[model samples]
Target: MPDKFDTSLPPFDCLSDSQQQRLRDALDVAYFRAGETIIEADEACQQLYIIIKGSVEERAADGQEIFAHYTADDLFDVRAQLDARSRHHYQALEDTLCYLLPREHFIALYQSNSQFAAYFDGNLAQRQQLLDEAHQQQNLAEFILTKISDDNIQPCLIVPHDTNLTAVTQAMRDKRVDAALVKLNATPQYGIVTRTNLLHAVLLDSLPASTPVSQVATTPVISVNKGDFLFNAMLAMTRHKVKRVQVLDGDNVAGMLDLTQVLSLFSTHSHVLTLRIARAKTIDELALAAGSQHRLVETLFNNGIHTLFVMELIATVNEQIIEKAFQLVVPPEMHDRCCLIVMGSEGRGEQILKTDQDNALILQDGIDWPGCAQVMARLTQTLHQLGYPLCPGKVMVNNPQWVKPQSEWLHTLSDFVQAGTENAVMALAILADSHAVAGNRALLSPLQTHLHQLLADQELLLATFTRPALQFSVPLTLFGKLKTGKEGLDIKRGGIFPIVHGIRALALEHAIADNNTFARIDQLTRCRVLEPETASNLSEALKLFIKLRLRQQLGQQQDPQSRGMQQHLDISVLSRAERDLLRHSLHVVKKFKEWLGYHYQIRD
Candidate 1:
């Protein structure tokens, strides 16, 4: 009756009530005083023990401590107890009470419940397979369970290539469809004609209504397989920046899937948020729309949308938000004289969650708007109210030092590369990832071109730039174990920063213009600056690290106390597969850092 034999832990939690009852009946309560040996190294483990109300410490075969802490509700001797022997010893660190289930009963439960059995029986390799399954499950977006074929696709409205535009319009009106697929010349190749295309041709180009349907259509249409997951269709649409995708059944054209139709299945956020931002007539309306952005992110992440896709989509929306804010705060006449740029992650289009505002304004030479400072301050404040916290580093357009003329920006870039001070290196690093988000991007173009010229073949400068990549020790120990500190490993510091900054430096050295970390990795490989295998490995490592950081970040918001905790990750909270992944990814970080030091010839 003491807590009814807690079976709430894993493996046991998966058991049926009857199985649980059997466990409850068989469970024997046992006690151990402080320093008492519950199980000795190299001895047979008789019973699987669950710490009901005390702490137990585990030691390796050689008496070196490993993961020594197990508290209430924790289970021990899972692997070793199953095998009837263990190489490690477990001792009670204080007065302890444990619910012990005999090995035979555990085997019985294991025999009946495969999932429960598998959890206990799995070796490291099998656990890795479980991890793959877990990741694959996470990869499946909510919409992915439905295939394109499962949706009620409108029938294809097939028309001949030579059919007149008048007939095409009539056919579309009759079918009540916005788009039609054109069957061209008996070949599988097809074209697409939408209402917009027709309108564009007739009104702008002044084509007669009698013009051939083919003339109005876009040639070589994009399509999604009927059997592909609905999520894939969404990804296709996002990647192509299109509003619709053609559905195909092998060589035959099926029909078109409008973005509206597809998005209606899920949250309004997928499409409506962007639509609202585009149509919003006032800054107030845009602010209201921005409120739903975090919900959208949570939905996307919970449903397992890949981080990069979320990054791209969110960046687009955030840019629109910034653009709208700029329009609200700036006069139309002044827009042409200045370029607005987002630096750091925002500039790279890799920003997922809201972070500090890192923006600047580049005014044309000899151009200054009279109330520029106040206007920029208002813009930064608006973004903050919309959830973009102001940059602690003061790298915002509101800072006069950051808001400079294009000529000054040029001089500053030259100074940074030549001076090579820590501040200079940091400034150039930020600019290297900078992207013009609003206003005239061309005004900022010349500065980038000049900066590239300065960066080319500057070895000492390159080494200085790459030096930060080697700043943090990779969190993996020499034997490939995750080395945790009191606050846990700083995953961002030890993993993400190395990959992001290392690739950024190499990109600057090789004069690669891509700012996205993933794209930089690929470009480096394609240019043979980094080997394909190395690039591929580092890419996986970076993505996994990003995923973990994002999860921790998202997790923190749910609990206020968690937000106060350092970004250091306690690996104990991670599952076997996640721990393995982190361990492996940290190893990748180690190798990448070693290569960076070797490439730059850095030493202690």
Candidate 2:
């Protein structure tokens, strides 16, 4: 054995110094020649093996089916070591050197270190979560990722509705707080008076100090739940362009969260980005803000924040950027008369990197705008210039087919549902996930109701809508190894689309209103449309697929010459645990696809 073993790898990296030394002291080295059997099928495994160099393969009892590949720095056969025997054969594909840790020592280490042991035990989701938590612990400000609690909330001053503005101001000053909550006798029941509101009321509006504080307070204040994520509170502040928000426990006020409180934890880049986007008077300035988004995503992801949180944050940021673009380009008078909606991944709020513009315009009925076409064309051009590429399928607002009056849009959806042609079904599927980003959001409600009603009991149409999800193979071989092409695997088609489309079909069948896949999965579980375990597996699997694909996409984007090359999952570079997770995740996908096929009664 080498004088020092590498303790930097996962599972091992989680071990304490004493645990590492104990493991190292018990380690022994072994070598196997090419084509030699390291461990025969059904034979007792005396020790755990960690490859130092070269490659090995695990095969079935018959030695004809390959199950997995383990390469340099890959650890293997934890199951075999624990069970004392495995119904699989291990053979060296090339000359191999490995360090062996005796079964007794390994078991002792496993018992001593729960984290190290969890790496070997638990389901894929638990294992991935443990890894994520381990990663997050490395970042000092990851507390921002935690939910809002008493630790982050501050006590707020509450004044009666009849309290004068001067009294409220004095109360705020005495409490050393920037805002105070006012008790209202009306429907909202509560309103907030900030220093800004007080200033505007007294100076700008020239109101008297003796006026009731309720008159100066803003009603229906923007607030976040006490149980909501601190990051979400920041998102609310970014979205509404406010510095402070009330924290609520049920219907009652808990405390207040200020922008300064959040900034004090860590100087945030997302807030700066949103502020820039909000203040951008020209498209060029918005483009600059848009350009920095990818770097921000990279920073958050690398800092070990949860992937879902990152997605939610990016989705909100993207929405704000798009909304700002809309306000800058469209005529102010037409804003309330129309709604802007994004479809596909953008609509689902799952998009990370900039992709094609899949958007449309829903105008109010009987409204006439002479230069409407030109305005939409300009908006599309501005988005393209802001880093969002144009849709090759022409799904953007620039295309007149996608921009229409609400009445005509509902009619179009009805026609599509009734026709049930392949193209029509595909179109309906796309529109099912549409989300309004700008303009009057209420305008799309009628369309949502109409579409849901049209397909209320249309079993045949639902099945047809679900058929495309199973059209692509799951990219797994019979023995459960990943299948890849010369360009690597197109995870988008092989894994992501199947899960997304399958979930969408289920949601549509049950009229689940959530557009995001993760939300849809939870709602489906609550409705018992999917078993709890299956729903959990599917959610975890989809997260893995998206994470891997995002890594590949980012890698491709970083390479200048790789532009225009289709992004694919490069399996050769994955660690053994990741590859194992990928296989297990794909198995989850395969099982989901089978369930989809049977549930929908889909036939060849």
Top candidate, metric TM-score: 2
State residue 267's C-alpha deviation in candidate 1, in Å: 4.3
Q: Residue 231 of model 2: what lDDT?
A: 83
Tens-place lDDT per residue, model 1, 119-217, is 656543343334434454333365655778745566768899999888998999998888888878758888888989998889999999889888777
Indicate which candidate wins on lDDT: 2
Candidate 2 residue spans exceeding 4 A from truth:
33-35, 40-43, 54-66, 92-96, 134-141, 186-188, 250-252, 558-563
Tell me the tens digit of each residue's lDDT in model 2 across 61-86: 99778887777777778898779887
Give model 1's TM-score versus the native structure.
0.71
TM-score of 2: 0.93
Model 1 misplaced regions, further than 4 Å: 1-132, 135-164, 174-176, 181-193, 196-208, 211-242, 246-255, 264-268, 334-337, 364-368, 476-488, 531-533, 558-566
Give all candidates' CA lDDT scores: 0.79, 0.87
